[model samples]
Target: MTRHLPSRRQALLAGLALAAAGCAPLPRAGTASASSRQLPQERVRAAAPFPMPDISVPDFSASRRFPITDFGAAQGDQQKTSAAIAQAIAAAHAAGSGVVVVPEGVWPTAKIHLKSNVNLHVAKGATLLFSERPDDYLPAVMTTWEGLECYNYSPLVYAYGCDNVAITGEGTLKAKLDVWKVWYARPKPHMDALVALYHLAAKRVPVEQRQMAVGQANLRPQFVQFNRCRNVLVEDVSIVDSPFWVLHPYLSRDVVIRRVKVRAHGHNNDGVDPEMSQNVLVEDCVFDQGDDAISVKSGRDQDAWRLNVPSRNIIMRNCRVKNGHQLMAIGSELSGGVENVFVDNCHFDNAGSGARSTINNILFVKTNERRGGYVKNIHVSNVSATRIAGGVLSVETDVLYQWRDLVPTYERRLTPIEGLHVSNVKVDEAAFVCRIQGEAEMPVKDVSLRGVTVAKVLEAPVSTVNVQGFVHAA
Candidate 1:
């Protein structure tokens, strides 16, 4: 039933097959003009050596010119603990120095606003406990979600619009264990303090002179959110009990998140949501979460329809994902598109019950019917998965999660997906569903598997494939 459907894109992409062998070196900051900033063909660029792609650990161990603090201050003066830490950050950022060490024991604070160009390293036994009181996280900061301008509740450890940042060492960055996800998806009356402050900040009121709206206890609080930053690194930190999403990197570039551990029981608490970024590397991380682990997004359907920016050039290698909905996702919110990505050398291990747990795998693309954008040029390889609730691999152009009979059209869909490759993958057990489904008319191209092995399958049915060469385990 293959018909020669002629179209503008089919004609163009007829010659634009993904024979893309290598990647050209990343351009220096000032190389490309605003007009030629991004190459359209760059979308097909194969996974090449980014040559230490924009992340490195520069010996923050010995360069501890910054003073250290012990939160075990015998005097219960919150001001002393607060002032000493604030001065340390200011001094560290001022001196172009590194390491404001939070070494051992619990350091409780109302709000500890992080600064630019500094590393907050915590020792193995140390814990930075943030005050549950919402008033501490005041002074509305500049941030964005889905690239829209709005006064949203920011993170506990907030850094919006900075560069060369990090949070290193093995310890716990603890938020109030019981607060949970109080106000992220919805607004509350008590959150008027944060809202009013944002309203005032939006009105261009002076920060110091703005009225302090208090006694409110509602606002979406992420454990850590670094927005619109570059060359960022988050390494070797164990985070627990976040109020909302654990680590959110929104609208950033050239970021590396390594060896971080996240365990939380809050809803929508994804380990990392890399929204609208380029050249991102998330490796060697362990996530046991409440919602989808490390889901990637450009924006939700409607908002994403307008701001059609893709999450491109992403690599998640050597990571372990357990207790989460599909280890790596093209997204539920794929308004723009996701292209040229790879998730290799990862493991999926888990028990049973967490809100995020599901058919975890290396690749899970489900944007059916209400398609906002496309997911193209994806690869998953060298992975071993066990005890998955769903399938080893799945691709959907329509959703079975909720409503049906709604076909997302051209005006709705942002882009098209093509060029998918999977190799050297093994799945021990899938107790439920696993399959691939694209729009009957617009079949996904270049989808293949070279040494995939699967067993103990139960739910779902799969059939149609458009790839040229595909091999499956017997």
Candidate 2:
């Protein structure tokens, strides 16, 4: 189901609300104090538009179908259906290239790992329900969590080292939330395991030696992940209640996620995380997420420096976000680098619920001193938002979370960010139009904002520190 954009009347109401709250617009380009010499009028510059990526989904014209029902699998029987589905996938893989059909029913299952040239298709009116038992995902697979590599629980649907893989159908992929909800609390054991994993990753231990599924690690796996795969496509699926990140494509290339709907308002349930992957496109999607709607990430710390693969040529367009922290976020784990990202013609709905009842920001770039990566060539344009509780744009360099106090900064590496452009954007209400805090030594540079309008802002419209060549012009 496609989400509808807010009407002009709604936008007007939002503007009126901000005005009633006594919010005012900031001064335009030339009206800053002498002490704020860094934010000069000449600093604002026009940005050249980035070219749209040329990407397409793979053609499966010659593929045959391998239906699960033909292999003795019935609905509601978790164990039997899970095995039967696996068998169907194997059969399709063995047959060169084929589609594995999941018929119309609520098929409860365990973990499902895809092979090359396999398309897992769930038919209309069907739900691929995952099991609530933790043991179902035992014998951990090689996966990354927050940026470190370790052997953790297998994702609900995983594809590793595959080619021409797709999960395309008009059906739902849901998680049995009873177990995952408990794991979200991050108890003592979970924190301890996280710290232990950080030490192992920082020390540059072999990935195979960093086992993490045992003990109380309880590291929640992603709902679906394509790891080190190429030519991947995920479309027309309604995902609900993810255990972790909803859709993750790590170290993959030529990936496309389009015409999808994700509603996973659980902890760490980012709608889509394109990590260390290149040539990616996410378009025509709807997201109601617990975290950032779309987060561009690379590797972390030593692990990232070893791989040295940056996430580039990523694009998100024609999307709508009902609830999210940031419509688009970069980093906190971007050690390898994130560049050449383009977001266009998207809408963010500030009408959220519970703790996120107020939308945080439309775009946020967060990194810390410990994360040594670069973020560049980010272009966002033609965006609209009804309301935002926080700043419309924020570039923070000292956003250290739990790791700030938990673990000491073993290596003091700082990121260099530049070439950010936001143009032709509109918002009805916001706390601030821009809030940027760059490092003293490594200041952010070359940020340009043009043709942007915020009807009302409660706080200062533009706030900056140690930034140069930042232009704010209508």
Prediction RMSDs, each to the true structure: 10.9, 16.1
Query: What would the per-residue lDDT of candidate 1 be over residues 143-246, giving only the tens digit for each residue?
Result: 44322333445477776555556788898888885444455444456434544543443343433333333244354566787665555678899998787778
C-alpha lDDT score of every prediction, in listed order: 0.62, 0.83
Candidate 2, residue 251: lDDT = 86
Off by over 4 Å in 2: 1-48, 51-53, 350-356
Per lDDT, the best of the predicted structures is: 2
Estimate the TM-score of every prediction. Answer: 0.75, 0.88
Deviation of model 2 at 8, angstroms: 62
Residue-by-residue lDDT tens digits, candidate 2, 1-474: 122343576446434532432222222323422212221111111122565445534556567899899887888799899999899988887776678999898999999988766789988988999998888997687788998878899899987766667898999999998989999999999999999999998887777678899988889999998887766789899999989999999988778898999988889999999999987888899998889899999988878887787998888889999888899999989999999998989998644433454458878999999989899999899999988888768999999888889888888999999998999999998999999999999999999889989999898899999898999999
The 10-residue segment of model 2 with minimum total lDDT is 38-47
Model 1 misplacement above 4 A: 1-64, 68-79, 144-149, 181-219, 301-308, 351-362, 368-371, 399-411, 431-434, 460-474
In angstroms, the error of model 1 at 442 is 3.2
Q: C-alpha displacement of 201 in model 1, angstroms?
A: 19
